[model samples]
Target: MLSKIHNGVPFKYLIASFQHQPRPTFPRTSPLPLRSRPIRTFSVQSILRLPDSKAQTGSRHKFTYDAAASFSAKHKDFNAATHVFHFNPYNRIQTQKRPKSKRPASGQDAFFISRVGESNAVAFGIADGVGGWEDSGVDPADFSHSFCDYMASAAYEHKPDAGDPTLTARSLMQRGFDDVCRDGSIHAGGSTASIAIASEDGMLEVANLGDSGFVHLRLNAVHSYSEPQTHAFNTPYQLSIVPASMLARAAVFGGAQLCDYPRDADVTQHTLKHGDILIFASDGVWDNLFNQDVLRLASRRMVSLGAWKTSDGGILVADDLKPFTQSLAEDSAQRSSTLQSVIATDIAAAAKTASKDRRSDGPFAKEVQKYYPEEDWHGGKVDDICVIVVIVSEEGKQQAIKSKL
Candidate 1:
């Protein structure tokens, strides 16, 4: 169903209660409404190898889409890519001390590719399945991946107008939820969703379900960001709290199922300009690193790789992006950094903090063990982590300038 949000409405906290199911329980917190203060808002061949960095482990996949290449072949306007997209997705099952004989199923984080039906405009989303669903005898990763697939398809099907990104995000989530519900394999599972759509016009639309969120970086500072919906620490809002019929199942968790999920996502809009960077991540990253740390890590990479200099610390546009965008200048700063750099940096940060010894058998370690007792958490809280960084490509910006002429 299409849920409406009155612009400028004061933020309202809508807590959903879930019944226990013999698993971890989250506090009773309604889905954090997307606050309106938002005046804001792959290498093939190079394809098969993972990074050799100490920070990045687990399974990694990277892809780069250039509009000047295949995408532009279709639309003449795309002769120069209006934007370039790079993604580095990684996953690792929580490490176990004794380690399960058979890697206990799979890590529950899932990412969706946002391209379909002939336009360079695309969207990206990540879903992290709630650990509580393991009790249902179902692999929660299946649900998380399924939700992403459906959401991407829905975005393609509805094709919201370019100017109306808010609707584009909302429609994608609402319709994606409806599609998932139609399938019976996923009877009861929960996940957090953070998605963003960038159009040819340089407009970005974002939506968050639960604690998943995105942060905008410009001029070495976080210019704007999303507020996570959560009942307490570690428990963010989720798409599926519980089934309407089996609300009693959540009893063991202390919270009762309060509302249907996949409803209208807290949608926000932003006019993306050159030199802006957007970081979309799951709670695993935010919970572990401070906002400044996140930015510092990214900035450090940009500088070390020569993508940006300390004096002008803006995002770097890829050097050879002529394949991605048509009007890219030969002399502009070439991006030497890869999505792997950012993803690996985040995973390393989380691992370091989670593994940091308090010098005492602190309560933090106990909290980490309490949740993932079987896994060798390596002094770090063991949870699935995902990060996606989007930067305005130099070629795309040059194209924008040319178009204005």
Candidate 2:
């Protein structure tokens, strides 16, 4: 549903005592109070070859809307995405993880929690599956699911190392990527990933692969996660991995070689105010808007916090004093992003504009375009996108990462 908050409200979550409000039937698919939309058709398909599966079986989480989100708390132990936001259709396909299989499985998206404290230390994420690749009857929905679980585990258990949470996060993601590659599915299927971690001290740490991102609303302004545009529309991210010497030989795109910089990083730290809001979304939600747009939406909410409840009474507090918290992000200057609303809006506008203009005919090509800027878009055109935006305050502190390795 095209849920909008042209005003402010309080924040709430896992509202167990709430009622289930199914999306109202609109003309579109399973419509329920969603924005008016006509069925969109794809003209081309794109293929994505991701890492192979490995044998590590256990319970994991995934999404059904080809999109998902992670938050600091748990409504229940059920494997599902926390933080109530509607699934973004730009993502398209979603999957879950399994044990000992070469790939993941297809299933409903559930929330998974690995507590760092009573409600302090936690990590959550969402991944979008590639559609064109799945057309061959080979869905990596499961692979994306496994990737999120693996990544979340690593984040929750991260060490302080360099105050560089990004480095640590990327290393873990690469390890996961490497594991899949070693198993033999490097070219089978792939997904876009985004994650957020809460520090016991009340800070934010984030990592990303592909375009999914995070947005933060502190006091009055909004902010976003790191920027990612590794390749141009004509090339692919992996294509640049070959012989540094050969690439040194061709150097075709002329763009700065995909920023060797990790797709992830350590977000700045600061005291979270009460009037704040954070949001993480797949390309579907972001491909259509920008930070100002998000701010515009936030300004509409008449309450301190407001998130349209989508899941089973998913509690999105309408009055959480987040406004008091976010109201300070800009003046704080001690942190990075302003807040989730700011970040999500900016990213979405760029991605949506870009997706509408892609010309390639790759498998899942429709999905990959969600990561670029609409006007001057040029990059590897990663197949899927994942985004995470968060609002923090004295009431909403980050869950610390418990070092595992």
Candidate 3:
């Protein structure tokens, strides 16, 4: 499903299920929204209070940020000026009926980050939540926060900085992951990691712990930057955390197991250009659409990237980003609400789609229906349709230069 379309035509990589029904008068919701939406924002204190590995075992640190001094140094003025827009239209399959369980963060998915000491550049990331029959006070979003912050701390504490910033970025992710996994406090489930780092010197690096991946959309081409694999094995030792069945499902698509964390995709010295977009996408969006499809939609408009500027003396807060992205789902309704900013979403929220379940009878086997299922992506385990797109302008422009006629 991750194929980019050129002029509304499907490419080889894009496998159109051929399961779409006639356009209905009402809106339809599915794994793909062909649109994006806004997400909730976490305060700086929330980010700071996250647990570092040492604290995971037992450190009494409540996991909160100190409000006195500022740790973020004007992230709005940043040179990258990357505008990110994303929506998880098919997030239901990932959510659960939430209840108290064996582990915290059972069914909560969050996008967390931790920056280096003085560098505005990020150092780590965490996502995915698991909750259901398996395991409550702890949300997966919480793990994402602590895990990312700690990763940055661990990397800075390295014996000595590696000469190459890119290598250092990679080392930071690898070692930090090891630290999180070693802790006895955290439990394992559906949670996954797709982390990355960019140093002040212009080096980029990323690593993922599951099928989720990153996309780099240049002016014309879209590049994938994550490897899909898991820790599943017939050997008893592998059963320590991740189950063999889960691992087998991951490997069904030919998974990889490298260095310490299953597998990863990296770049030694990837140089970025102006108008370039680097997206850290969850499976909800990536699994349903190809990377090129993203580029196609993004290239059509000049997204407001006020959030990525860190040099203009403005700090790109999550609030600054929410509106720009939320606009992707314009709603013509609710025009009087002062709180409403952008209206880019469709009017209807639900629709009756088609399914091929009736045509197939695989003897109760694989059940390959060879068709699409009817569903809505608005508020359940799959609640909340989302798509995050980050647009970066080399020229660093959110304003247009009007010419005198």
Task: Write candidate 1's Cα lDDT for 1-405 as tens digits.
Answer: 113212112212323343233124323224433322221122211111212222221222112232110111101121111122233222221221112232212257665555532344556776777766665566666667677767756555443355434437666767667666776766777777887776545577888877667778766677888877654434566777356656554454455652336554678888765555667766555544556666777566555544454545445544432232222222333333244333333433442344333332222233334443443233333345555666554333455556699
TM-score of each: 0.62, 0.43, 0.43
lDDT agreement with native, every candidate = 0.49, 0.35, 0.32
Weakest 10 consecutive residues, lDDT, candidate 2? 14-23
Top-lDDT structure, candidate number: 1
Query: Pairing residues by index, what is the TM-score of model 2?
Result: 0.43
Q: CA shift at 115, candidate 2, in angstroms?
A: 3.3
Writing each residue's lDDT as its tens digit, candidate 2 over 99-195 gives: 5352222221222223322223445555554332333345455455555555544444445443535433456556445554444443444555555
Once fitted onto the true fold, the runs of candidate 2 whose alpha carbons sit more than 4 angstroms away are: 1-114, 117-119, 130-132, 135-137, 155-167, 178-187, 234-272, 302-389, 395-405
TM-score winner among the candidates?
1
* Per-residue lDDT over 1-405 for candidate 3, one digit per residue giving the tens place of the 0 to 100 score: 323211112212111112211110122123432222111001110112112222131322111111110011111211111111122111111111122342222124334334343333434343443222022133333333345445645644433235434435446655545655665555542345566664433345665655444666553456435444432210000111343544565456544322233244333345454334555544333433344444444433323334233345432322223333323232343221111111101100110000112222211111111112222111111211112233322211222222222
Error of 2 at 220 (Å): 3.6
The predicted structure with the larger lDDT, 1 or 2, is 1
**lDDT measured at residue 70 in model 2 versus the true structure, 0 to 100:** 29
